[model samples]
Target: MKFCYACGSPLIMKDLEHEGEVAYCEQCRQYRFPIYHSAVSMVVLNPNEDKILMIQQYGKKDNILVAGYINQKESAEEALKREMKEEIGRSILKQRFMRSEYFPKTNTLIWNFAVVIDSEDLSQVSDWEVDKAQWFSFEEAITQVKPDSLAQRFLNNFLQEYKIKSKDFFA
Candidate 1:
């Protein structure tokens, strides 16, 4: 931060134990850390784990994973589950935490999860925020989401790790 949020003073780099150099305000006599928002992303899947769901939102051409910001007093899992029901009209029946990524452009830290929802209630997938939603095979899902994006990275990590773990679990 160029200026301190607490006291509107000029901030300089100051050595801090364990934290190294941080933005320190002489007037406030404290360190200032840049604030970033935290959000949750979900790799929606069906019960059998054979399909992955992707959504197109905000009139965007690319298919992206379902995600939303974590509200105050809500946990990351709660945020993901809420996003699941809000975006796709399905309650998450099962979920597993996957990974987190920081997007500097949006100043957002995203916690990703692999969520399983009942496919019996999947036909009517329309929310005001979501333009379109579709289910794809594991291979197709890996190809459908926007390339080189956080959505793609999260989906890839979950699917790759699931494969390894499934093999071990079965063995």
Candidate 2:
């Protein structure tokens, strides 16, 4: 930031011992380090695990996994659960962290999760954040999903390490 948050003075770059060059406020004599926002991206699967829920937001062409930023004082898992509830009104039964990566393009650190959910029918639930939502079979999901994106990386990584754990209740 050009201006210091602690004081109304111009920030100057100063190198510290542990922290590299950071913004220093002369008036406040405090250093402000650059902050990276933390976000959560999830691979949500039905109970049978063969079908994955993909969502397309307004103005986005490719369908993506449910994702959102972790709010202040909220855990990563909490954020994932909240996003799932907000996006599709479905609560995650179980979730496991897949991997963590930093996207330099967005300056965001994303934590990926593979969440097990119970609901298959999403006809009754909807969210403003998502324009459309549907369940895609594993074959369709792997093909239709965009490659080189964070969601794809997470999905690929999850599929490599774990089996599709599902128990078809109705079918």
Instruction: List the lowest-lDDT window of 10 residues for candidate 2.
Output: 162-171
In lDDT terms, how accurate is model 1? Answer: 0.84
Best by TM-score: 1
lDDT of candidate 2 over 41-82, digit per residue (tens) = 988889877788888887788888889899999999889988
Each model's total of backbone clashes: 0, 1
CA displacement after TM-score superposition, residue 139 of candidate 1 (Å)? 1.1
Candidate 1 runs further than 4 Å off = 123-126, 167-171
RMSD for each of the candidates:
2.3, 4.4
Off by over 4 Å in 2: 1-15, 18-27, 163-171
Per-residue lDDT of model 1, residues 10-117, tens digit only: 999999999999999999788898878999998887878788888899889898998999999999988887777777888888878887989988989999888888
